[model samples]
Target: MTLVSQSNEESTCERPTSKYAQYTGVLAATLAAFSIGTYLSWTSSALPLYNKNDTLSVSDQEGSWISSLVPLGAIPITIPAGMLADKFGRKRTIWAITVPLFLCWYIIAFAQSKIWIFLGRFVAGAACGAASVVVPMFTSEIAEQSIRGLLGTIFQLQITAGILFAYATAFTDNLHVIAILCSVAPALLLISFPFVPESPAWLVMQGRKNEANDVLKHFRGAHYRTETELTRLELQASEMREAKASIFDLRKYQKAICITLGLMIFQQLSGVNTLIFYAKKIFDDAGSTLSSSTSSVIVGAVQVVATYCSTILIERAGRKLLLFISVSVMATCMFTLSGYFHFQNSHDLSSVSWIPLLSFAVFIVIFSIGFGPIPWLMVGELFTNNVKSAASAATAICNWTLAFLVTKCFQDMVDLMGISSSFATFGVISLIGTVFVSTVVPETKGRSVEEIQIELYGTQISSIPRETDPEV
Candidate 1:
């Protein structure tokens, strides 16, 4: 991507191109998501082990803390991670995540006591938190308008694969082996991530015009010139950087912020994480004939398959429609699970023991299709370059904070209120999520970042229509 001067509008150079050109940036971030998936699902497999005397004997309360601490540790780093992404560059901040991630696994692999384990999880949480904010920002910056949704959904696809990988480790009984194996993901990511170019948008924001052009050329290919997109990115960056927006100034974009905050909150409140973290326990309690580990593995496999299907469909189906469908189905699944649990709690239902497993499978599939990926994808789309880091950090912090509350209280809620009421509450939350997306979120399919910002801010008319050519 040679930065062209105003006078040199034409070049004789042949355009360098590849079929995979558009996926370069998101591919790097997907590697990091693999590591995060391991961390997120680690507690699921570890919980059953913790209760066994062969491993560290932990009470139910202590196990809940293990699962919840990741989010708690994440709250503090949310803003700092965003700042680092802005100051150092997205690639560097992302690579930096591997250090703590490495330490987390080694600590768990070698720890003699529960205190060391707690500390390990906290560090892992911090890394996961940082990655959550930076990966989306980087992926969003690099993806072109034409395939943005396809590239963006890669984040969740990698996450699902990671969870499936963790579940695969359950086949082995050794905790040390599982920890050591999972640790390799981050190590692999750290070594390979540098080969990918830095985000062109970030380079432009830093006033490194020539480097930004080079990145654009690399990602966009030799045939496509960077002139139009580069100019727009520079203009957008200049406006955002010049404004000197702070976290507090986010209030100015009231509706956008509300949407960001709402998605983050609703994403967790839907009980996806709670179900994931307790997949084994939930399956075990449901009186299913299949072993708890086998049931949990099935759920993980379904998530990966479902996310892959969504990755293919997201570009075609449009964000709003997929979200509406995902949330509506998810609500119905929640109610189904609630009914199953209600029946079990109130009377003998030995004849229909399979309802929970079937219900969970349906819920996981529907959730993957939309609610799983779109919320994070939008985090990258909704904000301008200048405020993107700050706004995403705030949203990520809210996400983790709420996640902490839900994970910590989930088991207790189940014990006190019964699984029926607990799932019923999530069912209602899923219904609300449907309403929020249907009414508030706009269709961002096939629109440029500038166009999306213009439409949401209502500041000016954009040429982008409701419908656009897929190739454009």
Candidate 2:
């Protein structure tokens, strides 16, 4: 009857004394995140080479299609990726991501025609779409509540790191070398991720309680038996009632869905990708003294540093505080940048030549700290386990959809309305996002999935109590 006694399933795997063992799956997922980052930014390097008359000689039309195809390809795959993650297991779906991702890099590395590059970009986009869903869900299900926020943000951090890798590689003259180098990320992930544990929550749902307990023990260490964590997970599984998760079922967690989808929309509408896709052009247009490539590298470096900063501060300052701050600061930065552009367009550029560079640098840092990382991190935290896969997929699709629209329209908006007007439009969206976070989005730091759902439900979700909520 002792809670501490070893079951037959656990006897084969000795319980460890360390807490760090819990993060093995997180570490493995972080590798996949690196690959996602590479997918996102590799184009920055490759596109220039494709434009070379002696190279692929892509027309402007072909170049734009190559760039936009990623999110377009991502749109269709997200829901399927989510379903696969839930049904087959998070670990397996992640393993599958490596194939398409590797193919993406290798195709680009060896491509002689725009057609091959186009197909490569689509495959890369599919892998990114899959990773977007699976990594957060896997990380959420594996992490201890105390460190969940910290671990979840690592996804974004690795993405920043991957982007930086690509930006740095742009210094090399050979585009093929850059693509081949990016290939190393997925190749490493494919080789190493098998060592990571399958999600304990998924195992419990599969009715493999003993195996779940053993995995939980690995994550939580020797003291695991004394905790109610395993029982709570089993109860969560039971409460799900073998319900087949569908996109329609999201209505059950409407508040959670609204906040998640709202954040996704706001995040994209705030024009993060617009700035990223045209960092060099923005610098050149602004007449920066720094080389465009250097400015881009600086932007990438700032993002990586700022994302890591958010990872550290998130668990401490809390999600709501950081998000509010990020949105407010980003809006302010956009308005400032807008003003700079307006002045540059209308007046002498001598007085405020420094403004654009400074504004963009600060903007990248502010973005990396909150708006960049928290939305995706919260996707993993905001839902009940039953709807997690479906909800995450839906939100990711919305994310990619907006990303596509924004990237496609941003240049035209600048051309039609002016750079100042386009940025001003984004500024308005960021301000609205600030209000949304302040009014609707609940703080989720240090809360369990069940606890967060109950808070959102504003009722007894099963027997979990409102008064006993630790994260309140």
Candidate 3:
């Protein structure tokens, strides 16, 4: 990521050359590590109680804060998670979380009491908070400027894939099935710990300047980024040298704090986690006895595939364009499902049954390709290194806080408003999300971090993009 500063050149927006494949491999490992966040919480959907009774006292909707609770649980942990990544190497922070993540799932699998479940979920969510900070920071540091959007999105894409995998195990009553399945992710991630290198930026931060060069050898490909690139990274790290914000502090980076909150709140408003946790029930409402677990699997699979396609297409289409296409499709699907449920009521279930299920499946596909992957990508890239951690924590708070509200209210919403109206309400939210993405978001497709700063904060676009691509 050589910053061609004076001329305002952005990196060549070209796709990765064949050499970036290794970086892509590292991206996969980081993605799997990152996905423990989703996998840990997603298992709540398959709770033995929820599968059968779903009684108010046991698996009741009002009682189900555990699903979204972790994201909220994760809030207090985010700044520390980020600081750890900045202070220690990202791999170290990520590696440290792996054990707790595995154990939390195990406890959830076996826990007999709600107290135990809450504790387990709280712990698991904390691990996710750590991951949310570590993975993107690591990815951004390692990925080519040319492919950052695509690389950045891999985290979300894999998260969708993890959900699909979790839903795939929907049928079994045994907790081990879910536990062992979720455990497999961290187990694999643990293997990458010994092999993958540390974040170059973190190394530079620790004043291991000479050691930073060695790690950079593995992280960067033969097309050496110019000296200016290294200098910019060092300069960014220097700004943070004396800057440390405690978990209790929020005043220093107020703008980042607001944006983080907004990003998380809006991301949840897209109704993604609600749809995921309740995909089966939503299908059931639409007139399909298709086993809630089965519906989950189907939705999960579609999301996984759609996200993969997002990675391939995000660069070609540009971030804003892809987001518009995805949000439009999602909004359409939302309205279609909402109307089907609204009109159908309890009358003649035979008529409106299939549309909601079909609509939901379509919604999953649309979301993954656009809104699902893009939100996290944007949030990760939105903040500069200085406030990135605090911002991520704040956004995470909004994400989980709304997630808790949505998860807790979903069944109540179903009980009060009926399925159709609830879906309609969500559809309207998607339209709002579309509006926000269009007017507020800028094109950061191939921009350097500093260049993005200039564009968003009125600095200036970098020179790389303006300078002709040698490959072209």
Candidate 4:
């Protein structure tokens, strides 16, 4: 059966499509991503404070748990989060993220013991996992096809901003103060997101044509042709319903599934999270001239700037190209870090102490531009509506599961194999990731969902002509 049918009639009068509402909605949805970013990076800054505080008295083992718990907490919730987004609607599922995020900070802000602190971190991670599944779906569904890549990249941008926020707040020695500050983004999201429109795609999936039309009109502005878009949405929705997709049906879309899951696996294996979760510690261990907090703040700022550059370049550079460059450079940086650590084990390299800081800065910059955002962005682009939820859940689960393994095992790997060997291991994995991107990954830049499917399956899924924007 055809996906979206072509329309015979053309509008004699065309009005300009305003993107302000779309941007507003996307910004609001991505606040959840921002909150999750803060939680992910919280350990980098907070762990040190935990050790210094006489009241908390957290050990190295407990610190690893705190850093790892976020991803660990995410695993079980990912499948349920996908189901919730599909069943309850993306906006509602996103709104629910604020509850756990607020509770996470609140619990940590007043915790009297290690148990309370661990509980808080896990709760925060639950919010992180849920947002990972829902925010991308919400943003992609609401965006105009022309600007969809940019909007999708914004989720990662906000996440970088959140990481920067967490690092910046590390200046305060008071952990309670940092927790309070981290709560601000979710609070703003809670206050502002209610004004944003729901996903038109989700509305259409529920057979609410009129409401979908209204949401489209709101997003696209008054002069936009809502009916034509609505027809396309309806057709796609009908196709999905006919497929009756479930988790068991995933084998039918194996290539897309493999690509998405492989990207996630490589993303974690590249050791980005190990650096993010322990940025301060890594710098301190490297014997950098800069203080650990200062080094982390610099890396965090670089991350934000690089991710911003990515939003501008994504559609122009294409996904595969960026991934290739990103992974290649990352592998190089990992090898460079390994060499630095090897020499440091044998000699006092105070003269060349800046190597670790410089290596990680370049690594974070390259990572933000390519590997950091593309996997998450592709998650929204790679699958059909029928299996999208299931694929996203499975992909997220793989991502967090690997993240947990790498972050939890990083120090152990260092102790067992030495820091140089540990970094060399990530370098090899990243080198393999470069090959995976070059050979296996498909480019989805500036393409509609149906066109992407046609490329993946080698069959034309729709007869509908792709909509064009002269303004683009």
lDDT of 2: 0.79
Q: Candidate 2, residues 270-347: lDDT per residue as tens digits?
A: 988877766766777788777767877888998888888876786688899988998998899899989888888668
lDDT of 3 by residue, 286-348 (tens): 666466677667777777787788777766778778777777777788788777676665367
Candidate 4 segments whose C-alpha is farther than 4 A from its true place: 1-17, 223-225, 377-385, 438-472
For candidate 3, what is the lDDT? 0.66
RMSD in angstroms, candidate 2?
5.8
Q: Model 2 off-target regions past 4 Å? A: 1-16, 207-233, 243-245, 345-351, 377-385, 442-472
TM-score result, candidate 2: 0.84
lDDT at residue 347 of model 1 (Cα atoms): 89
Q: Write out the backbone clash pairs for model 2.
A: none
lDDT of 1: 0.82
> Cα lDDT of model 4 overall?
0.86
What C-alpha lDDT values do all the predictions have?
A: 0.82, 0.79, 0.66, 0.86
242-346: candidate 4 lDDT, tens digit per residue? 875667767667777889888998889999999999998888889899898899999999999998997777767999999999999999999999999899978
Residues 308-392, model 1: lDDT tens digits: 8977787678998998998888889889989987888678877888788888999999888888778766866777655666676
- Find the 10 residues in a row with the least total lDDT in model 2: 8-17
